[model samples]
Target: MYDVVIIGGGPAGQSAALFTSKGQLKTLLLDNEKGLTQRALIRNHYGADDVPGGELVAVGRKQAEKFGTEFNKANVTNVIKKDEGFTIETEEGDTYEGKQIILATGANSKLAETIGLNTKPSSEPYVKHVVDVDAAGRTNIEGIWAAGTAAGVSVHTIITSGDGAKVAVNLLSDLKGERYVDHDAL
Candidate 1:
């Protein structure tokens, strides 16, 4: 069992992994290389200057690894709340448990093409994923929170990363029973 498990490996997921692991929480990051940032050309992000999204993700992953974040190259099939924590099920039948789960799967890109229009379900099955968290990136599940695209904010890489940092601080505070750190502190 880990202290926390983050789903996805995009900017939000990476940011969460960094903070949690740095705070000494056993952390794991799961992604299947199909996150939203995978296709981003990303030339306008701050600190990135002109780097591509894929490169940024690579660097972030390396940094997280250096910080002791565990990486699981698997696709999560389902997440269920267990008695003590949460259980994550992967397509390969592997299971992981964590005291807290951050749903950072990022926004489902397929919805963009369907928005502002009405259509029937496709003859072929389609998956529609939504991140409906609020401004502060609070998830629908208790003891679980989210940020970045996973929280449904329209954000570039810079903004999303910032949100992830904020969520981490808040999460830490919740665990420590201390004052929540303001986003500016991050």
Candidate 2:
């Protein structure tokens, strides 16, 4: 089974995969390549002064792939909990097993409902039907997490990216059976 299966390709999912894969966890990121980030065109997204959203996605995915994170461009149709972990089924009729799942499907997406997680409407202005998550981006189900806009955070790429990193770190800590501090060098 893979260490983590991230269910989104947006900023949140990509950022999470970057961290998880860098942490040496076998990671798989599934996405159909159509998130709110596709429309992003700005200079306020941290490092870069100006860049298209698609460019960011491409660079982030490339970086994660360089770190050994697998990418699947398919629509995830269903997720089922198993004795070992979880099974993610895609519209392409493929299944992947993972020790953990992270939902980064963006705001108002109800992918969690298919997995029996209790989701609620977002209280944010004009935001609706966001997945319910705890402080650590945890869903009602164990081994499953919701991050970025999927967790009811703002739709901004910067905030969602940070949220994704935060959720990834928390999930990594849980998987290691102790607190995991990400250290780049010896």
Candidate 1 — which residues are off by over 4 angstroms? 109-129, 180-186
The per-residue C-alpha lDDT of model 2 at residue 115 equals 79
The CA-based lDDT of model 2 is what?
0.89
lDDT string for model 2 (41-124, tens) is: 857898977988988888889989999999989889889999989999998999999999999988646577777888888866
TM-scores for every candidate against the unseen true structure: 0.82, 0.94
Give the Cα-based TM-score of candidate 2 against the true structure: 0.94
Per-residue lDDT for 6 in model 1?
Answer: 85
* Candidate 1, residue 34: lDDT: 89
Model 1: per-residue Cα lDDT over 96-158, one tens digit each: 998987767666533222221122232222324455555555665666677676565545788
